[model samples]
Target: MAHYRECPAYDVFAPNCPARLVLERLADKWVLLLIDRLSAGERVRFNQLRRDMAGVSQKVLSQTLKRLERDGLVERQVYPTVPPTVEYALTELGATLGGTVERLAQWAESNMPAILLARQLYDQCGE
Candidate 1:
């Protein structure tokens, strides 16, 4: 593990480094938003997710869902309905993560004003 870090890779955030990949996924707002929605305990259809998360494009949402599904944080179900219904729900792992992510969301909501103030102060300092 230490040897991998000392390899002097050109990109510090190489695939060998798990933190980089996790940060990349967590950095995407859509991913967190999807997690938030799925935490609501109801199976969500594709169209419903789109409506719930306003401004998310179909491609982006699909891509995010795929990533979450791959990570074992979400479960995808396809029913043998007339139109072949597809729904998304959080897995046990996802539910665990949802609790942490929800707390993070709450922290952000409470501290946004302070964060903006800090940003404003930094900008005034001219970098």
Candidate 2:
């Protein structure tokens, strides 16, 4: 007799599915921005990331980075120095998402005008 292993299928739409938790993280605006910014494949300092993201508070950035680190999508390295220099970069798993994240960013930029027009039409219709 031969035995085979079974792989479980996950559906994000299901509340109890672990994939839903991942989807929640990926759907966060800050998480998306951080992933896109780090997609450049360079290790960036916390302050640099803050400046690049503009409008994100330091506290929020710290929290988001911690979450990303916990998720295994980002790697944080701390160098022993005066104040302890810290840098963040995407992990191999995170790098796999870079292209997809970059494409999503491009799509948003490319469709902004159309999106604005649609929003204006919707507001005018007052539906």
Candidate 3:
């Protein structure tokens, strides 16, 4: 079977669409948070990440970091020390995503009141 590549905007269901793959990554709940955390371009240790990302289990963080690293968005460095320290940092590509996510976080912070009011109105209407 042959598929069309001429029009991506019209191929919402196309299995090979590049946009879909990127969207899948961006839609993950932790991607934005991880990106935001690494936005400062500072190397953060594994324990530090766990501390900052409250409620994220060690397993989940490991999996998410693996995925991000595979996608060229994050870098993992292992240093030989007394305990063999491990660090995670964002790559250049991830910083681009970080800027966008930062703006989204800011928007969420600024609009929470209005959003809550809208939600209250919606709940009242349903009742």
Candidate 4:
């Protein structure tokens, strides 16, 4: 068995670290948006996700959901039915991330007005 210490290159902070891959995955706009929308503990359907995420297209949502599933952050459950029901919920790992993401979302929401004001002021000042 290979241990992390045995690896010659195991710097997580390095730009190319495997850990960075998780960051990159979560850093996506759609992923963040979807995760935020799903934070309410709602078992969201594909169309529901599409509706909740304002600007996300079906292709993008599908791709984002697939990536999240691959990363073990999102759980996809399929039910047999006439139309074939599909639902998405956060996995245990995803729940952990959801809390963090929700906090970040709250921060962004709280500060956006100020940030926009600063941008406006900067633009007005030609700075």
Candidate 5:
């Protein structure tokens, strides 16, 4: 069995590191939205994802789904039918990530009121 070599600290932070690619992909707007939606365990059609995501374009959504599938975070299923049908669902890895994203979302939601109040106060104080 071949053991994977541990990356040096410098290599880990290099721009070309594979870790950076994962971070960039996960931080994208469409990926974030899709992951959030899929956290509910409901398999969604492409059109349904577009509708639920609000501002995403068809092209962008298609790209995001493809990337997610490639990363093993999402599973794409094609139904056998005359007209053709496709659905997307999160894989186990995706589900684990969904929990982390959910926590971040919850924190943002919980603190939004405070953040708004601070913003109002700052505006009134001219700072």
Candidate 6:
């Protein structure tokens, strides 16, 4: 037996929409990087993630992980060991977003040159 409530329609453009809160979280650069990293479909150690995402401070990574976990986009697992082991992985919901984030990252990388040129032109003549 399954009981499902009808989900409400979300209008992200509405200032008062609850979806705005989620969009706000997803807009964060750290959050985007974390999501893009974990999209690989493997649980990664905290230290490994920190190493891979350069420029992320230890504190910021920790806080971002906590926030993602709270939002149901990440799963945190702990294994009892000498020093204890912790890893992060994407939840099913998060997995659904993986491809989208990956595409966004790729788009940024591929279009950066054009964007830079556009900015330069704007600065030089579009005043």
Q: CA lDDT, every prediction?
A: 0.88, 0.90, 0.88, 0.84, 0.87, 0.91
* Pairs with steric clashes in candidate 4: none
TM-score of 1: 0.82
Residue-wise lDDT of candidate 5 within 1-127, one digit each (tens)? 1221343442647755566668989888689889989989978999999999999999999999999999999999999987779999999899889988888788989999999999999999995
Model 2 whole-model lDDT (C-alpha atoms)? 0.90
TM-score, cand. 3: 0.86
TM-score of 4: 0.85
Candidate 3: worst-modelled 10 consecutive residues by lDDT: 1-10
Candidate No. with top TM-score: 2
Model 2, C-alpha of 32: deviation from truth (Å): 0.9
Per-model TM values vs. the true structure = 0.82, 0.92, 0.86, 0.85, 0.79, 0.90
Per-residue lDDT of candidate 4, residues 45-110 (tens digit): 999888878888899899999999999989999999989999999887888778888888899999
Q: If both were scored by TM-score, which would come out higher, candidate 3 or candidate 5?
A: 3
Worst 10 residues of 2 by lDDT: 1-10
Candidate 6 per-residue lDDT, tens place, 40-118, comes to: 9999999999999999999999999999999999999999998999999999999988999999999999999999999
Q: Which lDDT tens digits does candidate 2 get at residues 4-72?
A: 112146765655567767888999889999999999989999999999999999999999999999999
* Residue 94 displacement in candidate 1 (angstroms): 0.9
Candidate 5 segments exceeding 4 Å error: 1-12, 118-127
Better of 3 and 5 by lDDT: 3
Of candidates 6 and 3, the better by lDDT? 6
